[model samples]
Target: MKQWLVFPRQKVGLVCVGKPVRCSGQESCSNWRAISRTQILLHSFLLFTFLLSPIAAGAVDITQQLHRSLNSSVGRQSRDEADSLLSIGEQQYASGYADKTIASCLRALELYHSIDDLKAEGLTYNLLAKAYVQLGSLKEVEDSLRRGLAIARDTQDFQAQIFVLNNIGTFFLQQGESAAASKTVEDALAIAHGVKNIEGEGLSLSNLGLVAARLGDYNKAIKLYENALIFRRQTGDAIAEANTLNNLGDAYLASGNYQDTIATYGTAMQIAKTNRDRTNELRAIDGLVKAHSAVGRYERTFDLLEQPLTLAKELQNLREELKSFESYAQLYKQQGNYLTARNFYERAIILARTLEDSKQEVQLLDQLTKMLQLK
Candidate 1:
C-alpha cells in the first residue's frame, strides 16, 4: 500500500485499497502521456540502432556468442534471457500495458523457479499479484501473495516476509476487512521490531496507521505515522517520510484539524522538494491545494496549483493533467465560479477520453452532465 501523492512528474503511486476512487485527473493523464512518449522514444532509438548496424550476419553471430558466454552462467543463458524478458515486461507495465506485464512476469517467474532462485521467485509472485490486483482479481491477490509468503517463510527471510505481510494486509484492507488487515500487519510489525529492521518498521508502522485511519482511530493513526516518521528520518528515507507526512495530514484533515493538516502537508512538501521526488512533490501540492481550499485561502490555492499544473503538462502525464483540470474545477466550484468550472470540467473530460480510462470518462461525464442540468 503505497501512500501516493498526486503530482506532475512523480514516478510512483501507491494507491491504497478502498480509498475513494477519484477520476484519474490531469496528473494520471500526464503519467500515461509520458509513458507513451518514452515508448516512442525507445522505438526511435532502436530504429536508429538497426539502421546504423552492419549486415555482417556471421560476424554479428560470433560477437553475440562471445557476449552471451561472458554474461551467461554455466553456459545456460536461460536466467539472463529471462531477466531481460522480465525487464521488458516491467517497461511495458510502466508504459500501461497490463497484459504484457503479466505475461512478462509469468515468464520471469518460470525462469526463476527453473534456476531455483527463491528471491526472484518471491518477487515475481509479488509482481504478478500487483498486475492481478489492477485487473480486479481478488482471488489472484490472495493466491499470489500467499505463494510469496510461503517462499519468504521457507527462506526465513524476515524482510521478504514483511513485504508479503504488508501486501496481504493491503489486499484485505482493500477488501474492507479492517480487523483482519490490522491483525496481519500488526504481526508483521512485531516481526520487524524483533529483527530491528528500521525500514520495515517504518513501512509496517505506515500500514498500521492506514488501518487505524480506516477504523476511524485518528489518534492511533497519528501515533503510528509519527513513529514511522521517526524511523524514516533516521534512515534518511525522504520518500517514506513524505508519505508518512501525507498519511498524517490525511488523519488531521479527517479530524477537522485544518491547521495541523496544513502543517503536516507543508512538511511533506518541503521534504519532497528537497529530495527532488517529483511524485511526492505533486502529491504535496495536491494536499496543499486541498488544505488551502478547505480554509478558503484562494490565494494560496492559486499559488500552489500553478507549478503542479505546469509540471503535469510539461511531463505529459495524463493523470496529473487530469488532476489539474479537476482541481481547477473544484477550485472554481468552491468559489462559485461556475463558468470557469465548466471550462475546466470540459477539458478534463476530453483528457479522460483521450487516455481511454472508462472510469474517469464516466465520472467526468456524470459531473459535467449534472453541471449542465443545473444551468
Candidate 2:
C-alpha cells in the first residue's frame, strides 16, 4: 500500500517515499528529510506537468492540427495558444462567420474533453452556444447550454454555473418564456451572490431585467437594469454596462418616457463608440431613431439611420440593411411623401429578396403596393 504525506500549505497529498511518519503539528512535520533527491525531482516534474496543463479551450484556428500535435507531444499547449484560438473564434463570431466559429469551438472543445478540463469545457460550450444562436440553431444552443450547466454543476464551479444559468435565462427570454427566464436568472443571481462574483451578479440582474421587460413590467425592468449597470460599472465591464443602458432605454421607451429613452440610449451609444462595440452602437442607434421619431424629430431619426445603414452595408449585415430600409420607408410615409416611401419600400424588397427571406419580401411587397396606391 502507498502511504501519503499531506502538505498543509499546498493542500495536497504526496506519496510517502518510505515508511509513513505522523506529525502532531506543522513544527513536527519532518517528512521532507526522508524525501530522496530523485523522489523530489520526480515530484517536481509531475508538478510542472500539472501546472503546464491547458487553462482553457475555445474555437478553431488556422494552425489547429499543428497546435494539436504540439500539445500532444509537449503534454500541453501554452496559454497563448488557447488565447489566440479564443480570439480567432470571437472575431469569426463578430464577423458573422457562424460556421467557422462553430468549427473552431468544436475543435477546442475536443481538446478540452481529451484533457478532462471541466472549466475549459464549460467555457467552450458557451462559445458554441453563441455560435449556434447566430446560426439560428435553437436546439443546438439549448443542448450546448445544458452541457455547460452540467459541467459547471459537476465541477462545483460556481462562477461557471452562474454564467450558464444566466445564458439559459436569456435563451428562455428569446423563446418568449418570460416566467421561466425570470426563475432561471433568479437562480443565477443566488449562485452569483454565493460566490461573491460581481460580474455574474451583474449579468444575472441584466438578464432578469430582460425577462421583466418582456413581461411588460417596464418600471421593474428599469430598476433592475439600473442596478445591473452599477454592478457592471464597478466591475469595469464597459460592454455589459453599455448593454444594460440600452436595455434601460428600451424599458423607458416602453413606459412612454421618450426623453429618458433618448438620454439613456445616447449614453449607451457614447459608451459603445468609446469601446468600439459596433453591435451595441447599432442597437443604440436603432433605439435613438425610435425615440426621436416618437418625439416627432423626423430629421434626427433620418440622421441616425444614415450611419447605421452605412455600417450595415460595411458589415454585410443584410438583416440590418433591411431594417434600415424599412425605417426609411416608414419615415417617408410619416412625412406624407408617398413616392419616397414607395421608393424606399422597393429598395427594402430588393434587399429582402437578396436575403432569400420570402416572408419579409412578401410583407415589403404588400407595403410597397399600399404606398403606390396612396401615391
Candidate 3:
C-alpha cells in the first residue's frame, strides 16, 4: 500500500483524514498559510509556463474510485463521496500532483454542484485554480478563480472570499497589472479586516507591499511589509515572517539601505534555515549577496553566492542555477575580472540553452558579447 500524506485545509478550517484542527489564533494558522502561500508564489514565478511535468502517480487508484463514487450517485451518499473527493484533491495538490489534483477537484466540483453544495463547490474551484496555475493554463486559472469568487460571495464564505481575492490579486501582479493588483489586494485586506481574519489580512498586506514595491514606492512598501510582519509574527508564522523580512530587505535594497537590507535578509535566512525551506533560503542569500555587493563587501558577497549555487544544483532548478551564474558573472565584470566574468557567462549560456530558454539565452549572449567588446 502506498502511503498518502494528508494535510488540513486551513482556510476552511477543515481537516482531511485527520482530527479536527482549529486556527484559534494567527500563529496557529501560520504553518498552513505559510506553506500554501509559498507553493502558490513559487508557481506564480512560472507565469507563462509550467516548471514541472507530471510525475509518477501512487494515489491514482484511490482517486479513480472516489471519482466513480462521486459520479455514480445523487444523495447523502454522493455528498459524502464529494467531500472525500475534495479531501483527496487537496491532498494531491499538497503532494505536488497538479494533474491528479485537477482531475480530482473537477470531479468533486461536479458532485458538489449536483448536491447544491455551493460552499464546497467554491472551495473546489479554488483548488482547481491552483492546479491550473501549476499547469500554466491562464484561461483556466482566471475562470476558476472567478467562479470561486462568485461562489464565495453567494455563500457568504468570508474566509474563502478573502482567499480568492488575494489569489486574484497575486495573479494580476504576476501579469504586470500593478494597479489592478493593488486594488484587488486592498479589497481583500478590507474584507479580511472586516472578518477579523488576521492571516488573510496579513497576506493581503504583504501582497499590497509587493505592488507598492513594483510601483517604485519603496518607503510605502517597507511600511506595509512592516505591518504585515507584525501580524505574521503575532500569529507565530515563521515562514510568513521570513518572507516579509525578505520583502522588507528588498525594499531597503531598492532604497539603497544596504545595512538594513543585510540585517533583514539575514533574519529571513535564519528563519528559512529553521523551516528547511530551501527556496526562501536561496532568496535570502541572493538578497544578501546583492546588498553586500552594493556596499562593496565583495568577500561576503562571493561567500554568500556559494550556498545558493550549490542549492540550485541540488534542486535541479535550471533557472536558479542560471541566476547564480549570471550574478557571479556580473560581480566579476564589476570587479574588472573579464576572464572570470566570461567564464561564468559561458556557463550561464550553456544552462540557458539546456533549459530552452531562448529569451534568457539571448540576454546572456548579448551580455557576453558586450563584455568581449570591452576586453
Candidate 4:
C-alpha cells in the first residue's frame, strides 16, 4: 500500500523520491535528518534569520505599499500615483498575477475616471480585460474590452482604437472563437496598413499568425510571422521582432523543421537577452526545449528547461511555473522517466487547478492518465 505521510518540509510536498529517487522540497531541509525536534528548531532559526536579513520577505510588499499610498493621496499626487499604479498593474498583468492586477488596474481606473481622463480610462479597461482573460472570466473580458473599444472609437483615436482592437481580438482568440478574432484583427491590420503604422501592423500580423497557427495553417502562420518580423525590424521594435521570430520558430517546429526551428529560436533568444526581455527570453527557451526534444537532443532539452525553470521560481510567476512544469514533464516523458514526468505533471495540475484553467487541467489529466496506464 502507498504510504500516507505528513509533509514535513516548510515549502510544500513538491519533492518526494520513490524507488525513482526524489529530492527534498526545501533546499535547506536536505542536510537535516528526519523531522526531529532539533531539526524543527534549526528550521525555525534559519527562517527567522533569513527574514531578518536585507533580503527579508524578498520585499515584494513595496508595490502593495505604493498602491496604498496612492489610495490616500489627492489632486496631482493622486493622479501621478494612479499613473504609477497603472504601470505596476500592467506589469503584474503581463506576469499573470490576474487578481492582483485587476485590483491595481481598477484602482487606477477609479482615479482616471474621477479626473475624466477618457484615454486613461480606455487603457485601464483594456488592462482590466487582460486580467479578466487570465482569470477565465469571459464575460468580464468581453465587457471590459467592448467598453474600451467604444471609447476609443468615440474619440476617433486611431492608435487607441488599434490597441483596443488588438486586445479584443486576442480575447476572442482565447475564447477559441478564432473566426471572430480573425475578422476583428484583419480590420485592425487593414487600418494599420492604411495609416502606415508599423508597430500596429507588426502586432496585428503577429496576432494573425497566431490565429493561423491555431487553425493548423502552418504555412500561413509562417508567412504572417515573417512579415511581422520584417515590419518589426523596419520599425526598430526589437521586442516585437523577437516575438515574431519566436512565433516563426513555433511554426517550423509544428511542421517538423527542427533545424529552422532551432535557428529561429536561437535568434529570438539572442534578441530577447540583448533587450533584457525576460518574458520573451523564457519563451525562446521554451521553443528551444521543444525543438531540441523533437530532434532527440535530451541534453539540450534539459539545459533549455533549466533557465526558464530557475527564472520562473525566482520571479514567483505562476504562468512561468506552469510552463516550466510542462516542459519538465515532456522532457522526462521523452527520456522514459515516467515517474519524474508524472511528478512534474502533478505539479502542473496543481497550478492549473489553482488558476481554474480547465483547458490545461483537462489536457494535463489526459497526459497523466496515459502515463500512469503505461506503468
For model 3 the TM-score comes to 0.66
List runs of model 1 lying over 4 Å from the truth.
3-77, 85-97
Candidate 4 lDDT over 277-355, as tens digits, reads 6766887887888788877888878887889878877877777788789879877887789999999999999998886
lDDT of each: 0.65, 0.64, 0.67, 0.65
Candidate 2, backbone clash total: 3
Residue-by-residue lDDT tens digits, candidate 2, 171-229: 55555455655776798799888878888777788778777777888888889998988
Give lDDT: candidate 2, residue 89: 73
Clashing pairs in 3: 26-235, 27-235
By lDDT, the better pick of 3 and 4 is 3
Predicted candidate 1 versus true structure: per-residue lDDT over 322-357, tens digit per residue: 778988987887777889999999998888777555
In candidate 4, position 141 carries an lDDT of 51
List model 3 lDDT by residue over 1-375, tens digit each: 000011111111111112112213343234223322212222222311121111111123223322233343456687887778877776565444567888988887777777766656666776687676655556676567656655556556677767677776666666555666677778878998987988777777887887888789999999999999888788776766777788788889999998898899999999988977665687789889888898799998999999988987776666678888999999999999999999999999998787555656888999999999998
**Considering summed lDDT, which 10 consecutive residues are worst modelled in model 1?**
43-52
Quote the lDDT for 231 in model 1: 87
**Candidate 3: lDDT over CA atoms?**
0.67
TM-score of each: 0.75, 0.72, 0.66, 0.75
